[model samples]
Target: MTAALRATGVALEAASLIALRQVALRSRAEPVLAALPGGFATRRKGHGHEVADVREYVSGDDIRHLDKGTTARTGALHVRQFHEERDRVTLLVADFRSSMLWGISRAFRSVAAAEALALIGWQGVSEGGRVGLLALTPDGQVAVSPRGRVRGVLDVIGGLVRAHEQALQSVMAGTVADRSLDMAMSGLERLAPLGSEVIIASGFDDMGQGMEQRLAELARRRVPRLIRITDAAAGKLPKGRYPIRLSDGRRLRVSLSGHAQTQHETETICGRAALLIDAGSGVEQTARLLAANLPADRAP
Candidate 1:
């Protein structure tokens, strides 16, 4: 792994993820926005119930949201800035199947998925939006409802750790897979409210037959962003026999023929809007990819 990868601990840790909050905060100052459709109201702040701030009234300011006391006291027009009463909920669905338990560099694909979700969760919290989590493990699922501020972010972080650990245990036990991408999508549709924004982080190794249709149906009510996590060896590896360890702790040799398909199945499912991130990428790169892919309105 290059120095840029800057791999963290092999195991999942919340303290490490909490530390990324500062990085998430800094990323806002110098955002590298991606080209996406405009008018996403996921992070739209306007005249509503809760007051966000009071500022000098500018041209085009809504007079109804004006602060009469502040204007009278200062002898100048001032207005109250209110956050939309309806919470801008961002539901993060991270896949933790056995396939995500492997990685070529940096953290494991599962761990990297957690890191990505943490970064995005922090960003959502910073924007005064609510954040939730849905972790699809090999055995089952872990879901967290949308919550705002620090508590919400913490809930998501905790959920990620729990789900990852469950998946890890299942992998070690060599258990049969019980959860799949299609099931996760179904959980998302059931849990996510209308108008909520959904982001699913997965390796897409198990993009089931029904996934494309499920995602399409989800798009009608909620804005969904698919984040495809990949490893460094996603491309053709050198043709040779290599020793590998299985999830059950068994060792075996596998042969590579140097023929790997460049799959666009994820893009095809999401209508050419899937975000790609390498598992080998470090926190910095993950942050950049997220900022580039997420809706502009979601940024702080």
Candidate 2:
């Protein structure tokens, strides 16, 4: 049933793309983009450069990469052209640790991850790319390679939703699995072979000193680009005098009423630090940050 729901959602998503905006023309500063590396520029099917559509010219905009085929029809070189692809694999990683359940905004961390992942996958499909899936399973994790097929991406997401649902059940039933970050690292290893852009979604609460060391090692050795998700509650605690319950039946609270001023000051600093070292996109909230940071057109 969960699988079915995911499939239906995926179908609806693809259907929704019928309304996606397209830039049938190119601008002076624009070039053509290809799905695969080294894909060449070609002319638009019917028209040659005579008309063009202009859009925001990002700094990394490349002149040579423009599809003269498109411009030849529009007759201009305006850059931002959006296209859809049939197959491109997007890999998504979600963190299911208990910490993800916070947020005074009534929006759980899991919801945030889902929203961002959905937007990212939607953007991927808009570009005619396929989305892949990699996620935590409480007992372990999952990995799906990049595929151009829409069904493939849906399957991955369905598996993820089921895995998360099952994990939650296990916790309620008190059958904890021997899980760790190793699952994520191992999954990433599997995903690495695909050469697809990987997006790992996590609050990374388990990053103890040991885990942090391991992550640093992974960063140094694997050279992975990560996007970290964060929540307001995860940032800091104001001077407070209320108790908070723990999943393990224990309780704790902030009693900074005495040091409200001091706690508030400390919290401010700590909040920034946490944001600086977030799990995935780091400080960037939007996914385009990655594309934006790509080396600007060096092909002068």
Question: Quick one: best TM-score, which candidate?
Answer: 1
Q: Please report, in order, the local distance difference test score of every candidate based on alpha carbons.
A: 0.76, 0.45
Best by lDDT: 1
- Per-candidate TM vs. native? 0.79, 0.53
lDDT of 1 by residue, 136-232 (tens): 8888889999998999999999998888778777765678455557865566777788988888888887677788788888878987777788775
Candidate 2 similarity to native, TM-score: 0.53
Give the per-residue lDDT of model 2 (tens digit) for 217-266.
54443333344556544334465577876556568875644331211101
Task: Show how many residue pairs clash in every candidate, following the order shown.
Answer: 0, 41
Q: Score residue 166 of candidate 1 by CA lDDT.
A: 80
Alpha-carbon deviation at 8 in model 2, angstroms: 19
Error of 1 at 205 (Å): 1.1
